[model samples]
Target: MSNKIAILLATYNGEYHLREQLQSILYQTHSDWHLFIRDDGSTDGTLDIIKDYASRIANITIVDNAGEYTGSAAGNFFKLLHFSDYEGFDYISLSDQDDVWAPNKLQAALAYLSLDRAGGYSSNLISYDNAMMRTSYIDKSQAQKNFDYFFQGGSAGCTYVFTREACLLIQRKTVNITTYKGRSHDWLIYAICRANDIPWVLDRQAYIFYRQHANNVWGAKSAFSGLVSKFKILRSGWYRDNVIWVAENSGADVKGVEVFERVKRNKLVDKFYLLTIVSQLRRSKRECNLLVLILLFLF
Candidate 1:
């Protein structure tokens, strides 16, 4: 039997591009899939559009939200995963309400996962700005460094596909969590798999058209703008907080850096000590240098 995939789609006020994204999913080459959608208190026509699709499609399911608003895309996705019968599915994929998936996206992901014997899969994306009519390839498939998952996600969550075993591990890790600590879901998932020694494949192929818009929670930015944004986030101490949270919660046997414990205390000496091992923290040299600067000044 062909692999049956459960696609978890999270939506907010995404009425504008929701139809196009839904249409793209309907045209996928891999047809053995079920779509489970959950809305995070959308006050717009997003719910109506989802209802229309569910009305016509037998395999599409609208997960009941119980009138509780998650208030964030990551939270809504976590709720979707918690409520969906994912254990019954052979594989699981995540979807955003505004991205257009390639026709062969699922088929290609499944092929890579099977061939590599991997537990999780993610790929690069083609980020498109509709208003500007500009497109750029976003490459997130850099070589994995020692603790890269602790710093960033492998790729966009919309491009993520996980084996049943991977899903089980995620569910177990997040079972007792009441709050997500403002961390991206994709980062947490990648961290979980990596911490458990699960082989995760990062495909160089682009499988989704990641939409960039004014309301995007984490949209693409220009190089300079991205640097400025990172600076602002670092200045606010959010990065340090998240790193400590992941270290504590990700189940990794936090080794090597004996100063990790002191760094968690926000000590100045330990922060300086971390600057020496920045290469192990991030994947790219540019990012590693930036991380060192952040530790030296911002931390």
Candidate 2:
């Protein structure tokens, strides 16, 4: 028997490129998949396109968001995760409304993920500009290092596929989270995997064309270009706060839950002591390592 897969997609004003993306999914070589979509209050013809596809596609299902826009893409995806029916599914994958997927994307992910006891899988992505021209490939190789998971550098939620068990863990644990508090859904998921010591695979294959456009909540940023943004996060101490946020929201079984609590409750003077000793605080890429270290020391 073939494995059942659920593809969770969140859309907002995506009418222009949504059809191409839907067509790519329709053409997937792996056929035993169902699409579960939630529209975050699209004002344009995005819903019309989705309705058209739903009219013809038996596996397509849509969830109503009560006509309110989820302020962020992360929030929208989290909403889908919160509301989607998870039964009878062996795997769950995320999708972006504008990116065209490779026909074997799901197959390749399952191949690597099924070989081991991995709880989830993420892959590299081939990037494209607005004109459909190839831009570059996002690398997930160096990101395989354990510490790199905390940095949120190369991870994209659209490339993530979770085993049923992992999805269950998330659904059960995060059910009580009333708000993400600007936490990125992808980064939070990665952090949860790390905190639980859940084995995950980072595939080197680029199986999705990650689209870059002006409306993108977070655009592709090269190593050098991302430094300033990293500085601001460190300077504002949002990174540290987010670490605690993820730990708290990931439920009782997450490893280092106590440490996050301690950090969250610690005085300013104590933050310096705890951050320097805990290597997890230095979760930046090699290029920004020194900067992160310095900021942690001074902040």
Candidate 3:
């Protein structure tokens, strides 16, 4: 039997590019998929567009709590995971409202997952800027580190595909999360899978066109600008807090978790201690060095 995929899409005021995104999904080479969308109280014609598609597409479904407001994108996706009949499908994938997927995206992801016998899969993406008529390849498929998920996500959530077992694991792990603490769902999912020893494949292949726009929740930025933004986030203490939150919620057993807890106290000794083991914290060497600087001076 063919693998059946359930695509979870969370939308809010996405009428502008919703049609393109939906059409891209329809054009997928792997056609045995069902799209389950949950609109987070869209004020625009997003709902109208979704309804029109649902009326024509036999497998497209608007999930329950269609009009309810889920304050953030992560919250909306959490609701989708909680309420959707995800177990009915063989695999689960996530979709952003504006990205255009490659025709063989789903097929390629499943092929990788099955061949590797992995629980989850994510890949690099091409970030496209329409106004600038420019595109940049965003490489998230760097070498994996021991505790990297505690600091960063595996890849963009829009490129995520997981086996049914992986989806169930995520749902169970996140079921009791009362507060997101401003953490992205993708990051949390990656952390959970890694924490629990589930094998994840990070394919060094671009399968999605990640749209960049002013309204994007977290659009791709230039390398220098991205580092600066991360610095600001680190200075705000939100990054540390999220690390601790993820560690506790995901039951991470790494020694770095304890080190991070001490680092959170903001003591000189604790901060210095983290620098010694910084290599295990991030996937890229540049980020590892950057984290060292942040700890030495900023923290």
Candidate 4:
């Protein structure tokens, strides 16, 4: 059988740039992929654009969505999965409405994930570097270096790819996460990888462009706004909250199964090894005393 890939395009009133994006995919070096287009209630002519292409593109599957925003990114993506039955796709990639995918995006991301998940046992994530199309940015060398640098802070999700195993784990393992509305999608996805001891690797920014616009719900923010935005960005350690929240919001019964399995199999020598945490925290205060003094002085 031919290798299959599915690009889940979750869109809302994106007629402005929809056709161009579809064409970019068609121009890909690898064309053995399906396009799952979800119109999250487009008032624009987005559905029309999809329809125009569907007649010519055999692999396009469209999901009709209403304009009432889902209140959260998790809700939006979960809604897409529910519509697609999470079936018939080998590699699942997250697609945005207004972005441009460089021809080698799929080839590059798959190469990294293929190596990182060599055993093909569990979930994995692959992300890329993106230029802000219609805006000023750097050159090729800068983009390449920035891919790893940007990915180390996790992902911004314009071109994040997931394996079927990743989807299944979300379906099977992370049923009862407690993620909040208007929270971070990329952060929670990364945290889930961490929680289940699943492996993840950066794909070194496979030539993607994140299109910025005025009506964007997510992506493209120009500095924090007011106290609230500042607080949200400044709350540096809130990643834990995102983890717990995703489980709770999932509304599934994952108890005594997945997370438990992850904890049980953790290596004894791991930094937060269960046997050592109690002792480490106790010793931390004493050992970190000098470090704390230096930190305080430097600040």
Q: Give the number of the best model, judged by lDDT.
A: 3
lDDT of 2 at 262: 52
Ranking by lDDT: 3, 1, 2, 4
Residues 1-299, candidate 2: write the lDDT tens digits: 35789999999999989999999999998899999999988889999999999989999998888876767788788888878558888899999999999999988888888797688888888877855454998776453543444445336899999877788777776787776646788877876776677887878789999998767766575557567766676788787666566666664224654455556666665555555544554333553466346445633
Root-mean-square deviation (CA) per prediction? 1.8, 3.2, 1.9, 8.9
> Which window of 10 residues has the lowest lDDT sum in candidate 3?
251-260
lDDT of 4: 0.53
**Inter-residue clash pairs, candidate 1:** none
**Residue 79, model 3: Cα distance from true site in angstroms:** 0.5
Model 3 lDDT on a 0 to 1 scale: 0.86
Local accuracy by lDDT, each model: 0.85, 0.76, 0.86, 0.53
lDDT string for model 1 (1-299, tens) is 35899999999999999999999999999999999999989989999999999999999999999998878888898898888557568999999999999999999999999999899999999999978788999888878887787677889999999988788878888888787636788988888898888999999999899999888888797678877987788889988777666656667536423644756766777776677677877877887887787777887
Candidate 4: which stretches are off by over 4 Å?
64-73, 85-88, 118-153, 173-180, 223-228, 232-244, 247-299
Clashes of each: 0, 0, 0, 16
State the RMSD for candidate 4: 8.9
267 in model 1: Cα distance from truth in Å?
3.2
In model 3, what lDDT does residue 276 have? 78
Better of 1 and 3 by lDDT: 3
State every prediction's TM-score relative to the real structure.
0.94, 0.85, 0.94, 0.65
